[model samples]
Target: MNIVVGVTGGIAAYKTVQLVRLLVRDGHDVHVVPTDDALRFVGAPTWEAISRNPVTTSVHDDVAQVRHVALGQAADVVVVAPATANTIAKIAVGLAGDLLGTTLLATRAPVLVAPAMHTEMWQHAATRANIATLRARGVRIVGPDSGRLTGADSGPGRMSEPETIHREVSRMLAAGADLDGTRVVVSAGGTREPIDPVRFIGNRSSGRQGIAIALAAADRGADVTLVAAHVEDAQLDAAHAHPAIRVETAGTAAELGERMRALAGSADVIVMAAAVADYRVADVSDHKLAKEDGAPVLSLVENDDILAGLAGARRDGQTIVGFAAEMPTDHETVLERGIRKRRRKGVDLLAVNEVGWEAGFERAENAVALIGSDDQVVAEATGSKREVADALLDAIVALRSRP
Candidate 1:
């Protein structure tokens, strides 16, 4: 992949050094294009060393090769990290005053911008308009996350982490749009059933798989709504930063259920990937439960069956998918339990995985079988959660095509 990493003037320009290294490590043919002001934060030597390519900020350099136009023309993807307010305004108006701007004008490849500036500068009306203009032209924006910036200032305008930016860029490079024009609703993470203000029953689900699925759907051009519960701060920020995804937070199983119900009707595909608790405390205490009181007997009630409810009420062409996390004793038991769940839930598709202390839940990789309503395994996937998500979506797209 030919990736162009554009670094602009901003204190956050320092972070783009890591982004460049990540792209190079991923085996991408990376070209570093830094603006003059960006060189102040991280010099030409650093970018050249990291990207293993000559770094230049001037359109005048190598005039014979027309390097500015050539770089953009050859790029598979162009990502501008720490794109300052000035850089953004220039791009929005098609100004080609520098190498970065010239390359942007010359290329038709997907462009992603990660903006970093003061909160006030980012939130200014003119900057917002420029962003809107860029987005209107199909440019993807990553983030200016809400956090400490420069000195003691804080709020939206901090650059996203390098890993997050890398993932988004990878998604942009992958080719697929099977779910284009589709509306997808995905539920993720383990819902907490509060016992008291501070105590709750929640599973070890990190929401990685669910968020991966949501991101995968979005990568395929689906309008995605991710209903997340108990996800890590980084994961939450990534979801919010995704241009095609809308995020909704749900703290408890009931809240997740309500959110799913409300979003399911308008969705073409509904994926219930959350580890919703089967039961919640009957009476949630308003105050903290004291440890000095010793163990107390608590009443529990079964939570709403969100998957079954969606499946039962789904429109004719709607696709409802459910996930089953099982801890069967043997390999045979995995499929058996999955088959039974598929039949019982009456869902279009069920993704089943045998999860134990070591297998699933909070793990980076997972193995799952996609079972159809007829109790047959349609597909099986085993890899990083992102790969599995793509596999699952492939099945969903195939199933939706069937009469």
Candidate 2:
């Protein structure tokens, strides 16, 4: 794949260095094109070294070769990271003054713009109108995430992390895969139950699997909504930054349940991959408990079974998939438990995997059995979380085709 990574003038331009490196490492031919102001934060030399391609900012630099037109013509995808309000407005109005602008004007390939600026600039009427104009013309917008800003202030103006930009670009390149027009809702990460203002009960689930599933669904053209719980900042950014996916956060099992229930009615498929807590603190402390105050006895209460609830309340044609992370005595027990769970919960499919101190939680790779409601083994997947997600989606597509 030939990718043109356009960097604009913004503090977030520094993060595009990683985006370029990721594209290069993925065996894509990446060309870095930065605005003159962008070079102030990250120099041309850095872009050149990472992309292994010469960096440029002006159309005049390679007039003999007509490099601006040639680069855009040959590119499979063009991505603009940290696209400032100024840059977006320029592109929106078809201003072709610089190399990046000219290349963007010349490119017929898909364009993905990730805007980053202060909250005020982003919310300005002119900026919003320009974004609408770009979207009306079919330009894909990634995000200007809501979070901490350039200074002590924070709101909706943060650039998405590099991983997210890379994933969105990948999705654009693989356009028109399966799952087009399908609506998918996926839950990820481990829920955190607060015990006090400063303390909480949480698990080791890094949300890798759930993130993988959400990304996979987006890549396949599904309208994806990721209900995330206690996920890492980078992972959360990646989920929210995708153009095809929407992200919602939940801190506890109750919150996750509410989010899932609300999203389920509108979804064609729901995958409960989150490691939700089975129990929560019965009496949450208003203040942090101190060791000097002697031992504290904690009371626990059961949390609502979100997956079972979805299954029981499912509408016709809705497919609900549940995950069973079990610590079992034997290999047979894993399948047995998964089958039992599938039947008990009345879900269409149950993905069962062995999890312990070192197996599933926080790990990069996993193995799972996709057990059907009839207690039959429908399929098995084992690989990196992304690969497993693809396999799971394949099974889902197959199941959805049945009468």
Candidate 3:
């Protein structure tokens, strides 16, 4: 495979050296593209020697070959390690003042970025928006992991280890359209049950996991219908951009159930990943309640079991998977709940994860256990949402392949 590793300015640039070495050891044709500022940390000599491919920071170095565009055009994948805040912003907006920028703009191949910076910068609204923009364009983001940083600072601004980056790149290179010819329906986000015109009941689901699932299936060549309920706009951009995915929105549990039912007939696989409210206010207020009106009486009604309905009505050879987000006292308790839910819902598989004020919901990382029909834990994964998504999909593929 032809690989392009883009190195940006950051202390983590040193780690990218090992990343290039790993790729070269695997017999891949590795090309290193470094920004002028990146060379300050890891010199051009080190990159050139490690990759065994001439390295350059300026587009003028090989103007005759149009190296900037040629490298990107030839690459099977482009990885930017130590992707700094500045570089991230530049890439988000298509700034091509540097060679690496030009190559990035010219690439049609999949792009994976590993971010590294201060926690403040990482969490800033501007950076978040920029990250969202990159995701919208189908760019894969590894991590700015939480840990020790330069001096006394620390948080989610440390670039992922070189080995970690290498592993992800390897997976990207090895990925195939395994889900080709399959039709999948995935419901994501937390449904909003209206209480009044200005307010509603909802969960803290960022819809990142469900969106990751949809993206994973689509990347594997599945035609996907993503039924999203109250998902953030930034998170929805990727699904909307994916040609293989069709995005549909719903507000309440009932609306989500209706959408799922409408799409269920054509789906080979159905995943109920949405956080549907078990109850909704029986009577929605047409106007916002005033403070002087005192507390008004409220009535709650049970919602339909959408997942169970889908599982019960499943066609032969069709697969139905459900998600359970629990606040359990222990790991065993979570698994026990998952098994019971799987059996009760008649689902082929149930992905169970513990959630609380800090653990799940709105976070980038997740831990999940896949409970199978045999009342056994088939797979357990703890990592980024994308990793968990692939694990669930892996179980799905395995279940479908059973004779």
Compared with the true structure, all predictions reach lDDT values of: 0.89, 0.88, 0.91
lDDT of 2 by residue, 1-403 (tens): 8999999999999899999989999999999999999999899999999999999899999789898788898888899998999999999999988999999988766689999999999999999989877764446788889999998879998999899989989876765256889999999999999988998899989998999889878867799999989898876775776788998899999999999999998999999999999999999999889999889888999999899999999999999999999877745687787887888889998999999887998766789999886788888998768667877888898899898
* Better model by lDDT: candidate 1 vs candidate 2: 1
RMSD of 3: 5.4
- When sorted by lDDT, best at the front, the candidate numbers are 3, 1, 2
Give the Cα error of residue 48 in candidate 1, in Å.
22
Tens digit of lDDT per residue, candidate 1, span 1-403?
Answer: 9999999989888888888888888899999999999999899999999999999989889999989799999998999998999999999999999899999998866689999999999999999989877764457789879999999988999999888999999877774567989999999999999999998988999998899888878867899999999899887775787789999999998899999999987999999999999999999999998989888788999998889999989998899999999978655698899898888999999999989878888876789999997889999998768768888998999999897
Collision pairs in model 1: none
- Indicate the worst ten consecutive residues by lDDT in candidate 2: 132-141
Which candidate should be chosen as best, given lDDT against the real structure? 3
How do all models score by TM-score?
A: 0.62, 0.60, 0.74
Best-first order by TM-score: 3, 1, 2
- The TM-score between candidate 3 and the true structure equals 0.74
Query: Per-candidate RMSD vs. true structure?
Result: 13.5, 14.6, 5.4
TM-score (C-alpha, index-matched) for candidate 2:
0.60
Once model 3 is optimally superposed onto the true structure by TM-score, how far is the C-alpha of residue 42 displaced, in angstroms?
Answer: 9.0
Instruction: Output the lDDT of residue 160, model 2.
Output: 91
